[model samples]
Target: MGDGRGGGGGNRPAWLQLYDLVGKIGEGTYGLVFLARPKQRKGCIAIKKFKQSKDGDGVSPTAIREIMLLREINHENVVKLVNVHINHADMSLYLAFDYAEHDLYEIIRHHREKLNHPINQYTVKSLLWQLLNGLNYLHSNWIIHRDLKPSNILVMGDGEEHGVVKIADFGLARIYQAPLKPLFENGVVVTIWYRAPELLLGAKHYTSAVDMWAVGCIFAELLTLKPLFQGVEVKATPNPFQLDQLDKIFKVLGHPTPEKWPTLVNLPFWQTDLQHIQGHKYDNAGLHSYVHLPQKSPAYDLLSKMLEYDPRKRISAAQALEHEYFRLDPLPGRNALVTSQPGEKAVNYPARPVDTTTDFEGTASVQQPMSANAIPGGVTAQSMAGPRPGPRQISMVGMQRMPVGSMAAFNIPSQAGMNLNPGGIPMQRGPAGQAHPQQLRRKDPAMGMQNPGYPQQKRRF
Candidate 1:
């Protein structure tokens, strides 16, 4: 295990050289999860490798945050952080996880392409329930797993924990949030398709409901074997406001409005970003055409609540677990991969393709490039350089709340229309050469309120 902090690493550990290291099994926002087999151990385990932060000085802030927070989390459905190791020699930090043979993406893809086998409803129920169970625990403990997608979830192909569902990839997660920071500072989040309506509206502050939105998207994908809202993402800016992605959501879920969401109009980008499509015809009658679930069924009920446009109204993980969907005739099983009930024959999925070319010599050849589509709509989230910087409490003048004298007079002109960055809190300040969300330089005191190019009079307070 190499132990170099910024440049070179510590001496390579003998265990790393001895393990039957295999090729990559999966990739996530900040790291690569691969398979490895130790000569003395029984089965395979996952070696999640994290690259150093921006300067390549050491493990990224996101990796440290994940390693610290995940150490305290314990649940059957959650991927356990077995151990933390570092190779100072190469400045790489590795987290060991139980090797799950399959992820929901692979399972869904197998059914859609290679195997062409359909996933039974039982498997869907068990997988979703278990995933929710893990989520419920996280939310209860005040932790938000900001990234939740089909590929982020892992499942075993065999053993006592066999057929079990384990949620992975906490690189974008946050714990014990207080004096909330704007969500955009980190960079693109939740992949475009699963991103919630509020986030698209440019709500600077958000809640756990964002995760539920992703879960809803996952539920739909599991049933249909395809992304429900397959929108093409626009990467024009480092933080591009997701116009195209929002268009996709509006087409399927219908346009969000002040009538449906009272706070919808209050979002910073509501007027600046949403003014283009005010006349588009839409129906709020909902999800029936998209999901095959019966309109009145409990599954449909759960899906609808999960996809609620208003983050405040969206269903919580705990509430969703108690939904009638789980009370049906065939209750959810313990294993999502179990092909049959007890005492009956079983059908197990094929092993995932593992690259057998892991470097046992402890010398580097080439590093695998980060995959943007690792989790469908998920992006390689821009990670933070360090811990959340405390913002200086400014005077209460501009921050003061005032009643709307006239809605017509309060039009905000934004030069950066709906600019959205990846996950992570907007740090109060960033390193000298780095850029942070909260560090937006304000040249004009009026900020973006007045259009500099336009000859409009500044609002008189």
Candidate 2:
């Protein structure tokens, strides 16, 4: 395949032209995901380009966090960061993942709105097992995936990534070690609907139990093809209390008490909203209340343990993997992609949408201001103290069009006046494609110098 650039193609990296944009995979507040097909590879890769913050320069901390974790992990159940690329001109980062056809959110949406057929028991069992397997790996590593929802879990079918349900999107993943700042201090975590009760109550020091609660909600959603605890999110207020969200949970699971959850009333926000629930009684509708299933089912037990009121009592990912729900009848298949409902073939999920004519090859130019104040109790990937991981190899093309205006001190000629392409050199950058801290030229606090994956040019100014 020829480089997207019409003329002087070999002047840039050879790998740049290997990728053919299939379509856009998905878009979020964070970045845009694209399904790109490689010339050499048979299947496609999901390229997620995190949106550069309007307030700051360069990649956000979440992008760094994702690259750091995904690069270190080598698991089948987890989405692997296949490659990293940057829209050097815009300073936007792109992460290439093992492409997947469907996510649980899309799957649920398909079953509910697109198709009259519901997902089969075998498929559900397979999906749950794989989900737990991925979660167990993360929890064992002491990494809390603060955001675990249907949208974050990917499913592949009859491809290289086929029959596998990979856990993707690590925007809210945090490595928790003792003696660190309280988790909740990092602002709000997890989506409101799937959020654990403890988090809703504002627990400062929490556990991986938060993720388990979301899994339970996901489990319920899988059974019913809809969000289990669907709560209307309210806009932020000065003194915010999610009364409507809390009402959704209470109406179904009843209220927590001192006996059931000893630390129930001790949360910071709970104390502030104490008067609201002073003597109210919300009956425990149980799991069967939301989804009609047998009362004496092992699935119910697993769901109960996962949605346990007390984080202390919530089922760990490892424990959930061992539940009897998995042990019943036909065990989970190795791949949920091929797993089908009885008398039905696997449904073909559509390809992701992509936008062509995009130059995802550029570097971010940042000039930090010394007036920027240092953040306190901040747990950023760069701020964490540990043996730093090696640099991530990303495809990059720049130097031809350097942003050498007033923003940066370096001086270089424009694309027409000069030639600066590496031609065939493999692009490399610091961890998550950032520059090493030692090499960073810090003028501001937001340019997170931990991963400076930009190009080094010889200027003639």
Candidate 3:
């Protein structure tokens, strides 16, 4: 493909003509993520290149869903979909997003391994608050971000929006307000470490509470620089359940009881596999032993509510924002990097590294791009094939674009036709061509970290 500058008879795909591919930043199950420079624009853009769909269709449903949902919602805390493009050559799909330089995963890793100091209280509080704020918007719109791990939470770097948190990677997100099928039929969702207890046990029905559970786990990680639950995922087709994961949770939070969680007995695994799950009886709560916050502290109180046993009782994102935790001194700020306290110094977060090598080159013979109606925001590739038109506008009619954007377990009744992972892999977290798990490094919280009692993380999900 020729650079956007009109070389090679200007036969390059329209997407290539609009954005100059800088280099590949990350690769995942979907495809590859490239750092792009809009030929006519000043700032950078992260272009996600999706591979051909399984059926060799025009675009994958995941990409379409992301584009449709992003176009409908407009919030500073939410990652914006600048534009959608197609490489006519292979019929591959590409999504353009406002580049965010930092993510909570990288930031937490940096503070732990590089600086060797805990993140300031102000920064942690601010980051959490912004995360909840964005989550509140999604919940209000009936969108449940099934995947809310630390890596998916992006932080802006070196811009007017620097230090601001942007909730990203919506491939696994789903609109829970109404669904044609049971939410569980979609299969496993959240990453294992951050997964809610109800999901592990196979609850057949669920709600927005699943997301709040993930937020709680993220909050714990921000405080400790390590995944709160580091259980090894069983790779077999289906055995009992996520025994190690449930054990890990039970070890810390104590086993669930029907009294505390009214619907506990209704879960399929609880009724049928109770013997296997109840290997170790835990009667007392030991969460405080790992997290050092005072029991009476607002932060601890909020965390407890978020990690509540019952999904029905788990704290909502909106309620979490108004909790006493944010009401305390050193309140959250818009820019998480900037300290909210009067005299604290802002932590200088390093910029994300970009790879200059490995640019994307399409393989299929060039073909006319798909119709504009199929693409999000009513933008077509053919319209971009012509000469450069003024300064490039990545997001045209951004907010006005399109309309805006589960659980349960149980049953020993019959295992036939369940949405079990026959391959035994965790659910695909993000889009194929988007970022993958390259930066996901396992750390031992027992070594010079806050949660020394917890076991070492052996593998990266």
Candidate 4:
């Protein structure tokens, strides 16, 4: 393979020749992410390298699904799939995407730990607005981002699209237009901390409301620099219903009842596991206590709607963008870093750190390739060890946790909103770069070079 500096890489894959593998960004159960600079183009790119199928057959179903879904859609708020390449020698898959400098996870950590202050109100509002805007686009098209969390939400660094929110990591995203099978049959979805109540209660049939619940949790995390509902996960085999996660939510929002959620009685777990689920009683409704927002504040009202107990009543992304909260002072702008208020300095968040030690070639050689099983949401067998830099960038693929929050009383219906149909747009790629091969090596043991259990399989809608 040709080194990134324009050498003889004619024998390698097209990607290895087109871009210089600068460094390894992060790794998960399925693959590793590399940060590369195009030899001919002026900008950088994030190349996700999927491990060869365990059976060495074809591409992993998750990768195939992501490619299919991403290829069919295009929006500024959504992450762009630049290109896809396959290494026939190993049957590995490589997906190239426009490089995003920072994710919500690091941005939040910077504010909480390094800067020692909460993210500015303007930034928060703008971030949330863009999030809903992008989500509305997806929901309108019948797509549900099964995994929506801070780590997967990318914010571009200094560039033409700086501070623009791009919803990345579509490995768990799905089109919810009448599926071939129940979504639950594929097993758990969403990170544990951002999971929906319906999922925790074991609802077999679900909708885009699950995404809205995650957005609500993200909104709360933006307001309060911590996970609104920080419940530890129970990582048992076959994924048992998360009792701790549900209890954590009930303590804050009060337990759900048949009156509040009419369809609550229909859930599989609610019917079969009623004793344990109802073992403890909670009656206090106190969202006001944690959020500290005034009773009638637009922010509070909008949040309450998003976290509604009944998934059917959960605020749709389209409806949320029109909520009074977004209409209040400091109106949302395209760039989240800049405050709308005059005389306010743009918040300069630190850029995402890149590990240059391990490039694509380096990673492939050291790591043991194993096919990800049919499990969906769980932490990797090993987390990146020695951390000596900025916020760690781990893929939140197939992780689970229900969205957490206390709720104030509000009336709701028994059904969710309707999906909108929008015309599809073709993808536009940046100018192509010249070919270069780079031989890189990795010395980090904690980078998760070995693939563990398989994540969930992809299902067609």
TM-scores, all candidates, are 0.73, 0.74, 0.76, 0.77
Candidate 1 TM-score, C-alpha based:
0.73
User: Model 3 residue 13 lDDT?
Assistant: 52
lDDT string, candidate 2, 256-297, tens digits = 788888888798767877666646687777767787777788
lDDT of 4 by residue, 339-452 (tens): 656796767665444555566755333333322121111111111111011111122222122121100111112122111011121334222221112212122221121111
| Candidates sorted by TM-score, best first | 4, 3, 2, 1
lDDT of each: 0.61, 0.61, 0.66, 0.66
- Specify the poorest-scoring 10-residue window by lDDT in model 2: 377-386
Candidate 4 clashes: the total is 22
RMSD of 4: 16.1
- RMSD each, Å: 16.6, 14.2, 14.9, 16.1
- Give the TM-score comparing model 3 with the true structure, all chains together: 0.76
What is the overall TM-score of model 2 with all chains considered together?
0.74
Q: Provide the lowest-lDDT 10-residue window in model 3.
A: 380-389
